[model samples]
Target: MAAMYQVITPQKPAAILKGVGPKVAEKLSSIGIETVNDVLFHLPANYENLSVMNLADAENNDKVTVMGTVMTEPAVAYFRGGKNRLTVFMEIDGIYVKVTFFNQPYLKDKLIVGEEARLSGKYLKHKLEINGQRLIYEAGGGFRVTYPMGKVMHSKTFNKIVAEVFGGFSFNYDLPETVKAKYRLLSVREALRLIHFPKSPADIKEGRRTIKFYELFMFQLRLMEKRQKERVRNERYIIDYDIDELKAFIDTLPFGLTGDQKKCTNEICRDLKQNVSMHRLLQGDVGSGKTIVAGIAAYAVKTIGEQTAVMVPTEVLANQHYQSFTDTFEDRLTIAKLTGTTTRKEKMEIVSRLESGEIDLIVGTHALIEDDVLFNRLSLIITDEQHRFGVNQRKRLNDKAHRKNVLYMTATPIPRTLSITTFGDMDVSIIREMPKGRKPVETYWRRYDEVDEVMASIASEVRKGHSAYIVAPLIEESETLDLKNVQEIYHMFLDCFGEEQVELVHGRMKPAEKNEGMGRFERLEKPVLVSTTVIEVGINVPNATYMVIFNAERFGLSTLHQLRGRVGRSDMQSYCALISDPKTENAKQRIDIMTSTTDGFELSEQDLEMRGPGDYFGVRQSGLPEFKVADLAEDYRILEHARLSAIELSGEMREDA
Candidate 1:
């Protein structure tokens, strides 16, 4: 038998779904064309139906598919001494047309005699004489061959179809009836077909609507599924406590608790006292005293011979809690702090104290959840600014307490409708009122020239034994930004208020230096504190009544809101000054949100509207649902639909479960 060379068939670019080369895959990914399914899902950003008309009827700029042939081969025209230019001249039946392929030296070989190929582009007309040769050029449209019209194609991705079966594909495939009616959508196959090759303009419009709704519906469905899972794993804490003791603790507080705070704390404590477990969120305005309320619930759990753990997002907040609790329930509660700043020996000691139930209240940052730090009968856990904590991280923290009652605090006020829908797992408590003697912070928006006036105001307050906070947008200035760096700003203020009166603090500073700067401000040694956003959270200076934010527009409203909260802690009237450089009307609008209202919930709503839901709550956080196309603020109807859908789906799933 003759040795037969086995013939191998090379895979076509379109046929080979897998094993796409890296460079081609990257290019495809850029256009969102990944897997075969992704290719199918790659709906056209837009569609255009080619106007097939005579060259005479075609407008000068209209893109038309004119059936034409090569009237002549591509020719090269030289100018002056040695200017080489290649040009292709062609014409259709009874229409004078020209095609120019520029600077392509190989164009002469690429175009054969009487060869036919399609070209699509804009039309141009210019009369030029090259090498004494007069050429009348009339450019009308891009060149293209005649084929079955109605293929959806993006302008950038034109000529990308390498598939042979594209023309043979038929749409109108049936989809699940439930999906069709629920989303008011069409089948994917139909949408793809109509988008690429629409029979009419109306078909393309309807196809687009169907695709948009389908995309939105799928996102809502995934969110609903997540809500259901959280519900299934729900746990309410067992609060073993005497009701009278909790009441006594509340009544004994120096100032009366706000009705909202009391009500929320009761709800949380009730959940803790339950047989199952409690996972609750306590969201309030800045300076609303969420920490103190959390401390009360934590102490309630400690009454039953169990320890309580409070985790803050930053070390400053942790230290604040450590100092506050250590003073509030002094001797009654043994409080320990565990942070990155804690030495190995101190950590081990704290860990030992925690395991032995000697530490009644442990306040710290992420160090509280490290592997070696175990708790003995940890019955309650509270997380400050809970949105910053990861889902898995919160789970681990709660698990470390072995499913103890969880209370999460957030200075960011979420809307009630949003809270009930996305945060359904947790019972919410809102602190709408400030403690008595804590004056409402007065806010002001000033242009750069008024900076001296604001600083003078801050200095006047500081001279009266009051403290002030000077905040900057960044620790250091970027090449693009001409704003003063935090250190430089500190020196400027020091020159204004003397070196002994002002102190500087930034994230890049050593922990001890930060603590020192903060301590000096706290102790009134340095009444004016110049810093970055690191001081935005959990810095309680009852004496600090003035907050001067430089380049205010560089910060977001929510963040600026938090910074403003650092003041107005004392009975004396406090103030916040937003000093914007090169201020414009847009800058005024942003800063005006703070100056207009002291209501955090209102500010939160406005921030949500301005920044969109995903960005306002941060992209990788648990507090808000991720929405792609639907605007939570503008698309309240869609939000309602998804919310109702989630409620109904969860209700049904729970009943069945």
Candidate 2:
């Protein structure tokens, strides 16, 4: 096996593997496993430590080993098209359990009738169906590694195939010994072996940690290089305003700034004066007065005789910011808005004014990045809800100026750990403090059976002259819940609250239609607004005090928090009632987290833990590179170590250069 390494290394393709054929190789390639190294590096989504149990003892969603007799022949039924759902009728100590293997028609031949077999899978409670059930020859011993594309092949088969290859494979991507020793990093060989076949749970954990470090370290090094190159080329157009001017501007505002807001403002002000182009991420929870902080930055740019363009995610958000900025500036400077709904003639005029620098500060959506829309001496580009804009869109708008300074504002608050690691390229300024007079939303969790009580509470809030948001989860992705429709729920609300008091909004609604629905709610014409997650970041109404999210299990911790944030924008006592009977532990955790804290940062941290930095916020959307083994949300400490190491390595590279 050791001698095989001399001849067959990672450079070889999957075709050289012991059992891989044309079809198997083709399936493997779909998951980016074309090479032998790819197979070796293919990480597991999760591992299940097999626990042997009888079918009678297995509860719902339990990962238990069932040593059973194949009581019936494996029956395969064609579903939809050429694909098949294979069901194997098995008996564990006279108790029947149905094993389901989706899209694997060939598994029928493997499950022989009238024979004893060992199966490991998640047992669906109430019913005897086992989802993701894998047939194993061994009864029980070690953990089962679940792959990303397990639907195509059995985990047992993958284990055997990889073990044969691992016999010869050597981990070659090792860092310098000095760097490794300084960071207390593991050798690639040990890391890979333990990550794949760990002897203990601690081994799996440490193995994951080491892999995460390697990924983040390399990613940071690459980003540091790009950042260094950018700093050399783009020098900021020096801002004329100082901290004193920013303070004076804030003083005129209708409200006082929180300490966190003030600190963030000072950081942004300091960055504006620097010679290097300032790139910053301003993160605050919803209604945390980040807009006012942004207003100060925009005003500073205006004083410097430069224009600023504020880009937002939605048309409603663009309009809301336009009004907010207009009120804040109060004729101190010029402000304009350009949205997709803007007429052809109005858009032309707005573009003309922008080109002539007539608009001192313009707030708009993606329309601001249009090719024909040119800016005169565009100094600062501030993007609100930074995750909404594409990386190219932001770059395209920023390229219009000679030396562009960008400030990204996000109401989606993240923990400091994620902020540092995810946005390593940008200087981060945090506004953790919510403004005074903003009420903490009272949150509640319930099962679907308690909908009547939630509805009654909404009516009570509405009768008190407060508005309510009826957030319904659209089951678009799930086939099991295809019959369930949010529109049907909207109709139910309409019947209960009257059509005049209820308005519907969803992703499929036309912009005009959706805006009208939210507009009516904002104007107080409608006391109850039924919407999908489409209203996640839209219209902000201070009067809205009741927010009820249906099927809360469908949303992530981060999303649920954001939805809850729609209310509690004002001093009025608000309520966020999360309604769902979550079956899975993960679903229960999300609901639990929401009910526990109104802190966006805390919820985001939990979200990162429960669901690994999913495309929930800016991690994937902001064009930041993703890690293979490292999760900035869970292994944030690892990220910090990698970031520091990368920074040191970057300094050495610069000195050598």
Model number with the top TM-score: 2
lDDT of 1 by residue, 1-657 (tens): 000100112212332444345665566666545444444444444443344345555555555444456667778887786657766656654655766654545556655657654444445433311111112122443222222213333333432442312443333333346546785766755665566556566777666555544444444445556544543344334556767776777677777777777787778877775666666788888888787888888778777778888888899998888888887887767888999999999998989988988988898888877888899888788888887888777777788875567778888788654665457656678888888767778898888777888888977887799988898877776898878678778878978989888888889989988998898888888888889889988788888888988888888788888898888877899999888853566566778787899888888878877776667766456656543233456665555554555456556666898
Give the number of colliding residue pairs in candidate 2. 0
lDDT of each: 0.69, 0.79
Q: Flag regions of model 2 displaced more than 4 Å.
A: 1-173, 176-179, 189-209, 233-236, 242-245, 415-417, 475-486, 491-499, 618-628, 631-633, 652-657
Poorest 10 consecutive residues by lDDT, candidate 2: 1-10
- Output candidate 1 Cα RMSD: 9.0
Candidate 2's TM-score reads 0.74
Candidate that would win on lDDT = 2
- After superposing candidate 1 on the true structure, give the runs of residues whose Cα lies further than 4 Å from its correct spot: 1-37, 48-237, 415-427, 436-439, 476-478, 582-588, 617-636
